[model samples]
Target: MASPASQDIKSIGIWIRVSTEDQVRGESPEHHEQRARAYAELKGWHVAEVYRLDAVSGKSVMAHPIAKRMLTDIRTGAITGLVFSKLARLARNTKELLEFAEVFRACNADMISLAESIDTSTPAGRLFFTMIAAMAQWEREEIADRVKASIPIRAKLGKPIGGAAPYGYRWRDKKLEVDTEAAPVRVLAYELFAEHQRKKTVARILNERGYRTRNGASFSDGAVGRMIEDPTAKGLYRANYTTVGESGAGWQLKPEDEWIWTPVEPIVSEELWERCNGLLAARATGRRPAKKTSYLFAGFAVCECGAKMYVPARRGKYVCAACLNKIPVDDLETLYRSELADFLLSPEEMSAHHAAANEMLREKELLIDAAESELKKIVGSENELFDLYHAGALNKVDFGRRHKPLSERRAQIEDELPRLEAERDVLKIGMLSRDEVLEDAKDLSDKWPDLPWEHRRQIVETITDRIVIGKEGVEIILLQVPFGNDDELATKPLGPRFRGDERY
Candidate 1:
C-alpha cells in the first residue's frame, strides 16, 4: 500500500532497551519496540532491524557486543536512522550518549527519540540533542566530584579505601593481614638490602634462590625498592598520602600533613626497617655508579625464564639474575647480525613483503575509487534537485526537506575521501620503510667494522626484537620489517656457547 517515494525514503532501525527499574514497573521491551515500529510506519520508513539491549544497564553499553553491532550497522549504511523510545534507554552514560550522537552525525544518520520528540532529521531537533548531551555531561561531572570527596574521609576511618593490599599483605574480611608465604620473602629482601646496600643486588640474590613475588613474577630492583620503603612491613600502614594524577601522569604525593598512618602487624622490626632505609639514604647522597658502556643488544636480550639480561658493573656478559643465565655480549651480537642478514637477504622474504604491501595498496585504492563514485552520484543528485526546484516541479518546503539528507551525505563523503587518500599514502610510505630496513641489514652485513656505533645500534634496534639465552641455546627474535606478520626469527635454538654456563 506504500508509495514508491515513501518506500525509498528512509531505512530505520528500532532500538529497545528496558532497565531493571522499568521491567519492575511492568514496562516490557515489546511495548517499546511496537511503539518505535508504529512511528516508523507512520513516517513511511522501512524497519530495517531491531537492536535490543534487554536487561542491560544503560550506564555503559558501549562495550556491549550488541551496541557495537548497532554502531557498525549505522556506519555501513545498513540503517540510515534509529528509532528509540527515549534517550536514556539508549544509554544513561553521558559519555556514551554523546559518543552515539557523534557517530550518528558522522555517518549522516538520524536518531529519533519518541519520548523527547527529538528527530535529528530537522535542524531544531539536532540543536535539542546537543543540549541534552551537554546536560548529561554535567551530571557525570557532578557524580565524579561526589566520589572524589569521599576518598579522604574513608581513609581516615581505617576502612579498606580501595585497591589491592600492598605486597606481602592480603585483605581478608576488609582487614589487611600479612601473606605468610610472601612475608618471609619480604623479610629476606630487607635483610639482604641491609647487608648488600644495593637494591639490584638484593633482587638478583632473591631471584637466583628461586624466590618470586606474590604475583609469581621475578623480583626487579624497582619492586625490591618499593617493598623496602613501605611502612606496612614495620607495623604501620600509610594511606591518603598520594593522589593519582590526571591522564596517566602517575601518582603524586599529597602534602605530608594530610597523610594518614595506622598501625598493623609487623613483618620486620622498625629497627631493621630504619637501618635498611638509612643505608638507602646514604647511597642516595653518595657518588653515583659509573655508567657502563652500551652493548650492541643491551636492552634487547632476555633469559628464557622471562627475566631481562643485564650486564653488571665491570662485566663483559649479559647476565640473567633470575636463573644466573649468562651469555657473552660479543657472541649474542654476532649471532643476531648473522640472523638479520639471512632474513633481509632471502629472496622469498623479499617477495612476500612486496606482495603483502601491493595487496594492501590495491584494497585501499579500490575503496578510494568507490568513495569517489559515490560522491559523484550525490553531486549529480544535488544538481537535479536544484533543476527541479527552479522549474516548478518541487515547491520550496518539499524541496528543502528532500535536499537536507543529500547535503548531509555529501558532507560525510567529502570528509571520508581525504581520510582514505591519507591511508593510501601511509601504505605507500610503509612499503618504502620496509625497503629501507632491508637496505640497513645489507649494509650492516657488508660494512660492520666501518659503520659508526650509533648507526649499527640503530640498525640492531630496528631489526632485532629480542635475544633469549637459555640453558639449551639462544633464540634470536627479529622485529617484523614492513607492517607484515612478524617473520619470527627461526625458533630453533643455537649452539652451546649461548648456554647459561658461558661466562666472561
Candidate 2:
C-alpha cells in the first residue's frame, strides 16, 4: 500500500562513513554526504544533522559505538528518517544490515538508501531493499573468494599486501625495503639489547640518542622487546597469520603452516637478530639479576663465555655467568689501556690523522690565497668603475648598482677570511684531545692513588668502544679515531656485529 504524503519524513539525519583508508574505491566521506544531501533536498527533507564515522573501519557494525549511538537517536525519534549514501556504509554483512533494519522498524523510524532509492517505509521499497541486500551479499562473497585466492600468492611472493611497512623499512615495488635512515637505529637497538639483555636499558639509550620508532614515538621496554622479537627484522616474513573470525568479523591467527615466508634485505645479521630474540625469550621466562655496581665498562664489556661482563658489588672483580671465566678488574683495565689507550700517543695510529690534517692545512692555505686574489680583483674593479664614472664612461646609477653588489660580495669574503684562517688544524685537535685523555688516564695508575674512582672510570670509558675480557686475554676495541679519511669508517655505521665469538 502507498503511504500518505503526511507520513513523508520532513526532517532526516545525514550519516556518512569513511573507511580507515582516506579514500576507498574512490569514495570520500564528503562526496558521499554531498550526494546524500542533494537527494534528501530533492524530497525537501531538512538535514537535521550529519554524523560521520571517519577513518574508522575493520570493526563490526555492532561493535562500533557510534553506530549504537545512532540507533539510540533513531529510537528516541531525534529525526524522521536516517539516510545514508549507500547500504554498505551501514553494514558490510547482510546479517548486520537485517539487524539494523529490524531496529529501525521497531523504533518506528524510516530508513532511506539514497543510491537504491529504497524507502523502507513503503512495502514495495522494502521488498526491493531485501532483494538488493541478497544480491550485494552474493557479490561480496564472490569478491572475498577472489581476494582469498590472490592475497596468499602475493604474500608468498614476498609482497606487502597492504597496510604500513614495518619499522626500519619502507614499501617499494609492493615489498618492504630497508629505510636508510631508520635501518641503523634498528640495528643499533638490536646490538644494545643483545649486550645488555635489557629492553628498558636499550630503550633509555636509544631515547637519549634521539632515535624514535617508525611512528615517531620513543621506544618503551615493551615496544623494544616486541621489535627485537619480530621476525620481519631478519627478512623472514610471516603472512596468513590472521584469518577471518569464525563467529563473524575481525581476524584470528591461522595454523603455523599457513604462515607465509618472504625474504627481504636484512638490517642486522642473523646472529645479532637471534641473540636479541634469545635474550628476549630468556627475559620473558626469568630476567637475570641486576649488577650491583656501575663500573667504567659496566655494560660495555663482554665475556667470551657469551654473557655480559659484570663487576660484582666489589670493585676489582669481573665475572661471567656462562663460563668459569673470571678476571681481576685491575689486570683487565691495565691490559686494555696498555694496548689501545690513546691513539694520539701512538705514532702509527696518528700517522693517518697527521697526513689528513696536513692536507686540510694546505687546502685552507690555498683557499685563503684564492680569497685574497678574488678580493684584490673586486677592489681593482671598483677603482676602475670609479675612474670610468669620472670620465663619464658609465652612469652614476649603473656604477652604484654594479658596485653595491661587488661591495657586498667583498664584505662577505672579508668576513669569511678570518674564520678560514682560524680553522684549527683538525688533525691537531683530534690528536691532542686523545693524547690528553691517555695522559690523564695514565695518572689514574696505582702511582696516582689520589684519583677518585669515578674520575678514573670516566676517563677510561670516554675512549673505549667496549672491553671484551675473553680467553684470548683482554681485547679492548677502542673507538676508531681517524683524523684523515674519517668518512671511510663513518660511512659503514654499525651498532655492533658479532662474528662467532668476536665482540665489539
Candidate 3:
C-alpha cells in the first residue's frame, strides 16, 4: 500500500442475527458475534455498538427493525463501518444487498463480513460481494425448484400441502382431518344450496345466521358458492388451478369428475351425496337431462339366445336385439327384485347364516381392540423415554438410540389402525342389512313404472347387475351381496313378474 490504512479512522458497528429461537439457544449467533468483536478489536478499531436481531429472516430487509436503525446510523456518519458474520447474515436477497451496498458507498462507509473475509471498501471486496449476490440468487432458485418438484408427488400421495385446508378440514400431523368446529358450517351451506338452488340465497342465509370464516369475516356469495362446491365436505381433496396473466392471476374451478378422491371418513351418506349432485345438475342444465341410463347391469343384460336385451324406448319395454323377443319393463323389474331377495336370504336356513355373519363381526371387533391396545403400549413407552430425556435422566445419544426404534414402531401401528377401523365400519354397516335392502326394494317397486324409461334403467343399474334374457326366460342378477342370505326371500317377488313375450 502507498500508506498504511488509518487504524483509528472511524467506529465500527457489529451486526448479529439469529434466525430462530432454537438457533438463539444454540451457540451460532453468539459465537459469530464474539468472533466479529474479536476481529474488530484485533484491527485496533473502536466498536460503537453490536446490533442483534433475533428470529428474523434474511430474505426481507424491512422485517428487521434493529438492522434498519443500523443502516440509518451508517448513513448519518455515526458509524463508518458495519461488520457481520457472513454475507448471508447481512442479506440473503441479492437486490436488497446490492441496494444497501450502494447506500454504503454513498456514505463513504465500509462493509465487512468476518466469516467471508469480504470488505466492500476495496475493489476486490466489491467483486466478492457481487459473486456472493449471484450465489444467493442461485440458492433461492434451487430452493424454489425443489419445492415445485415435490408438490405433485405429495398431492398424489394424499398429503396436504400449499394452501390452507378446505372449509370443513383442519391441518393436523401434516394431514387434513375433519374439523369439528367448521363441519356444521359446511353441512349448513350444502343444505341451503339444496333447498334454494341459489348462491345468493345461501350467502344471505349464512350471513343472517352470523356464520363467518375462520378469521371472523362475513361470508360473500362467491365464498358460500365455493364452500358448496368443495369436495372436502364429501371427504375428498381437490386441487385448484391458477394462471398468471397481464391482469395478475386468474383462477378457475375444476370439475368434480376431474377431482381426486382421497378416501377419508364420509360425513354424508352416498345416497344423500348423489341426490345433492342430481339437484345441482338439474339446476345447472335448466331441465333435467334425461337420467343417466348406463346402469351396473346395462351392458351385462344378455338374452338366452346370446343377444343383448336393449331398452330402446321410454316405457319399461326391453327386447332381445337378436331374436326380437320382448318383455314388459315391469316384468323384468319384478324378476330382478325376486332374484336379489333370493340371493340375500334363503327362507329355509335363515338363523344359521345370520348367526355366522354376526359371529364374524364380533371376532373382527376383538382383533381391532387388541391392535389398539398394542398401539397404546408402544406410545406409552415413547412418552416415558421422552420424559426421561427431558428430566436429564438420559443423554441425547441414549435418548436418540431408543427413541428412533420406538418412533418406527409407532408409525407401523398408525398405518394398521386405518385398515382395522375400515373393517369395523364395514361390519357395522352389514348389521343393518334388512332395513336397507327392503327399503331400497320397496322404493324401486313404487317408482319403477312412474319413472321415465331412462330413469328406470338408471335405478335398475344402481341396484342390479347381469340381466340375461333367454329363450327360456329372463334372468336377473343383483349387484351387491343380497340382504337376506338367511331366508328364501327371492321366492316372494316385490314387483310384477314377466312371462316370455309379455307386453306392458
**Collision count for each candidate, in order:** 0, 0, 17
Error at 83, model 1, angstroms: 42
Q: Sorted by lDDT, highest first, which candidate order results?
A: 1, 2, 3
lDDT of 2: 0.61
Q: Which stretches of candidate 3 lie over 4 Å from their true place?
A: 1-160, 252-265, 270-274, 289-504
Model 3 Cα lDDT, one tens digit per residue, 88-192: 887888656765675565455678765454655433355555664566446545644655577689889996554687887887865568889888887887777
lDDT of each structure? 0.69, 0.61, 0.59
Q: Which ten residues in a row have the lowest lDDT in candidate 1?
A: 487-496
Q: List model 2 lDDT by residue over 1-504, tens digit each.
A: 112122222456878887866475655576567656655543335676677888766245655667755655554344547778667787777656765775565444568775554555433345554665466446546644655578788889987576567778888876678899888888888989878878899999999999888778999998888688777787555555777997877987675435555556778765567556545544554533211225656655668665676665664667776785667766655555445434434566556544554666566668778987998899899999999999999998999998999999988886665445333222222234344555554434444346566555545434444566666565565533434443222111112322222321
Clashes of 3: 17
lDDT of 2 at 313: 62
Give the backbone clash total of model 2: 0
Q: Runs in model 2 with CA error above 4 Å?
A: 1-160, 243-252, 287-504
State how far residue 260 of model 3 sits from its true place (Å).
7.7
